[model samples]
Target: MREFDYDLFVIGGGSGGVRAARVAAGETGAKVGLAEESRYGGTCVIRGCVPKKLMVFASEFSGLSEDAGLYGWDVTGGAFDWGRFSTRLNGELDRLEGVYRKLLSASGVDTFDCRATLKDPHTVSLANGEEKTAKHILVATGGRPVRPDMNNADLGMVSDDIFHQETLPKSILIVGGGYIACEFACILHGLGVEVTLYYRGAQILRGFDEEARGLIAESMRERGIDLHIGTNIVEMDCAGSDDSDTGMGGPIQDTGETVGDSGMSHRGRQSGDTSDGPIRVKATNGSSRVFDRVLFATGRRPNTDGMGLEELGVKLGRGGQIEVDAYSQTAVPSIYAIGDVTDRVNLTPVAIREGMAFVETVFKGNPTPVDHALIPSAVFTQPELGTVGMNEEDAREQEEIDVYCTSFRPMQTAFIGKPDRVLMKLIVSKANRKVLGCHIVAPNAGEMIQLAGIAIKMGATKEDFDRTVAVHPTMSEEIVTMRNPVRSA
Candidate 1:
């Protein structure tokens, strides 16, 4: 019933918006408002990070079941309840949503659990037609899945839709080659499902260090995942005879060449459904297989649609992410945006930093630009991939870089007798011997990279890494004792 609602208004209850609202409310003791159409915690908490990590753990643990004997544990034929796993995932997400809500409320920020449409730089209208006016506004609405229209009529779903899936697929064909695709590939393959990952590019994990990418690929194959690189989907329709209505997958090809025998040969032909019957899919390489489900983890774009940003004249770049400067300020001076919406280093922690920076510049009278360098990230593949700083390829492309790297099978594998190897790489500026990039692919690489990130942020050099003695019998020590530095002219 308050006529004038808040001093600060935040749209999109994702990471950036939430952080800004919380800090602004707590520090300034100002009445802050936040609005979210979806469940709180944004993509990272609800979909991207939390649920994905859980799925990865489920997948990895299934593999651990096989390696349990090596760790002195025995396992008979054990059953896994996909339903239980999915239920637990949902519970964790719910708990996280509750925690996010509590944080906002406890910090004295009022939240509107509805969509926020900007009426002006200062005014936002909610779904219930309730309007709030503020001195400043921030938008942090995150991205969503871009579903393919051609593959639409089939039973396949995108990365976002897979978490709440009703049934665990016996076999799944995941299309696309980005992190989301690769991450889910690790998850499904770890879950013991027959998984075939298709990437349109030559390599799966692009932008990471090449050696780490190779290592992850090798581990994936060792774990029995079928990776189809340089493959694509051309057309899809439902598999059914005498029924022209539904969609089916046709044939799958590799590099424009047919590979395997069509498994749907026995289904018989149907009118308007091609020679293959219903529930059929066709790959560009001309090989066809019937899968229980198809998944696409291609990539993500910014979520600047339908929230009335066009009317407000918000400019977007690089897949519709709002363009912002150092202080997270958009073109419109009074309006601000951060997090995935800004598309600058689309990580949760990065968003939080930008949010805090916004508050400092606006309310605290001190300005700091968002620094993305040395931001550590992890890809939870088996023998998990972690990185802070630049990899050799990116470093070379960006600057004159000297590279040092090593690959060794972990010692645990020496006892358990698995041949899968861990690969680590460092990119140092040849001009200054600065440790600009650190990359690793190994078990717990994500956790291991944290220390490396701190070192890199502290301006550690290759010599600094070498000056530190190597810790024996651990996979992480490769970072310190990189002997040969490969210089790129």
Candidate 2:
């Protein structure tokens, strides 16, 4: 008789969990079972990356007509039908969730479409009170968007709520300066909505290269994003409520509609609720305004709450992230965790790689450790920002470095008299000549950085980049042509 019902059972049917379960069951021939309380593809497919990128694409069209006009084409912009786009977007998400299910089924992995929590180190208890035993268990429960702790804070929408928004608001107050906040700020602005962003920090994109982030902030302000630094929400309430008074003068004029029940007021516009009016907000700067919606892009936390993890002796970080070793093994040898649950490199690709590493270690006996260094990331703001390796600020603090940087208006929009600028910068180590970082801020910067990431990952040096011939009339050619170090630190 088998000692356990399955060889491996995964909790959380996300990219990491699904990848690990499929590989272990199909390739390694291990009996596997997986469970997810929500959609199978988790945040990336359902909410975070895929849907938001589509929104970025939809939002980009709002500015194309003017650029096209400069190119001698009489293309005029048209109204954006959120209904049509959202319908298609939701359809796409449904298809993706189905694909995730099909992949697991084809791999011969058993999948339970319900929440599963740890009953013990090797035992999982499903929401239906069914118990499943496995020789090894992997937790990939992903992260979730969280609202700030404040009165009436529930009135604001989180990143997950964006996909379900049936209609776009006329004006939105996006709180936070992270990539999520900035991306949506640009996105909504492009979609013809008034976007006001408030971040209680000196600058947006705080940890990125200073020069790159500065340029992005400049471009965003130029593009009409009402961005305010060192600003945050002091109080918020549904427009016209008795407690919605802003000490600036008096309460914002009520539109004669009462606040809807629960969180429905935020999404009430979807149902064309006349009673659902804008949200009144008072800022730290002693300003008062009402926005059709208030989006809190502050942060995310790992989905480890009430999972019975701490009871099983699994170490959880301050952020509720499951603490695991190099091989993704927990304090209890039978339990393992990966993906956002581990909170190490929270990108989708990193989670998938961690899942693969977990399978290699626990199932194949190879004991592979997760390698997280030199990971490339992109902020999908207007013009986009793609970066790989250390930022200039961090690199200089660690060791001596040479920074080769260039900023210019690219030819594509330059001829049109558009002030759209792009930046290409490389940070090189003084001692080893290795390119420590590459940062690009321009159109399709995300795509350009992926190619550059390969060279940097292989330890390509500044001379190696210089020796490569420049492709003429190309902005990227500057990567190879720049010879002198603009600055060293």
Candidate 3:
């Protein structure tokens, strides 16, 4: 048998890769080598979840100050200092990156700070001109936010760029109606930015429970986000230029090469002047506007380009996601993949679970299949949304379901004369009496759904939820108190 450099070679330093590498090395005592070209903590720790939640907490203060007065506490709202917050956020991220490095090192996994790509089925090539062979290779490259191929799209920023902004814009036009777009729109608005949101779809928060999303949309509007539905940007250019229609000029063509999956070009000039000018924008709705910034929270694609995977007979999807079986094994049995790169669940915790499953299957001589079902998720919109299992629309398509839902003004908000309302909903399977789904739209909904998720995951029945006595005067008590079915399908 030919001797390989290591027992395993893992690519990408994100959650999946690091977890797989460390577990295989520490627990299974596999000779693992992991390589990461950027920060080790990956998207969730470095850019996606942690920093975004901090911003969410910062944004909540504006409402907290108002609610304080209603509760007989004298609290005053103050201006948010993005500079100070961002500085501290960056420092915290740096500390986290260090922790990831330390964990990998202590696990006895050899770490490489350079990009690594597949040279062949068993061979790997690094950016620093190093070549190594492994018995098994894993790819967890993850994904990146993408902008649509519209005119002057480069002038817009993606979700990743939001963290690196030097300062907050006085006003911003946020495009797309997905969770990322809605979350940032709320965060920016809370931080005192004049936020405007545009979505080409009829409504925001698509793919969620209709009733829950409806309440979230109404709450977002009440919070003062200038939301426009069924709309999109057609053209954009720098303000103060008189070149063509809309008094701003034609679309600023992307002359530079595309970078990664983000759909951004390096050579396109910015859409505004250096002296604090707004970017001219023309929307499909025949509306023209000028804004300090245009943020495209449009969508994201898998990060698979230029990685040499396709050349190695690793099947890829239309979105560049790796084609994997239940074990995350690619067509090439020696190769496996997990996390966003596989496009399975696309959640950080799911990615970690997939990674651990991969290690158990490959290293421990035990075949483990990842379970992607009944995973709870939360969207950090102003009111927030927490959901688990099948939504109403999807459930009704396959089986008869009873929807038990309630929407009411909470006692706290009612005391303040606030128009805010919360929603709690349960979708129960009629045949099995099992709680097929649970959705909540309210403050701290994310925290609430976590406990609810445990019960639903265990196949808890509607009677099980009923037997659990309700906690009085709590918003979550509505979850258990909702007995009568509002509708059945």
> What shift in Å separates residue 22 of candidate 3 from its native position after superposition?
0.3
23-78 per-residue lDDT for model 2 (tens digits): 99999999999988878788888777888899999999987898888888999788
For each candidate, give its TM-score against the true structure: 0.90, 0.93, 0.94
Residue 166 of model 1 has an lDDT of 71
Position 177, candidate 3: lDDT: 82
What value does the lDDT take at residue 126 in candidate 3?
A: 94
lDDT of 3: 0.84
Clashing pairs in 3: none
Model 2 accuracy (lDDT, Cα): 0.84
Query: Please, what are the lDDT tens digits per residue for candidate 1 over residues 11-74?
Result: 8777777888999999988789998877788877776777888887777667566687778898
lDDT of 3 by residue, 169-279 (tens): 999998888888889999999999999998888888888888888888899899899999878777787787773643333332211111111111111333231224578
TM-score of 1: 0.90
Q: Report the number of clashing residue pairs per model.
A: 27, 0, 0
lDDT of each: 0.74, 0.84, 0.84
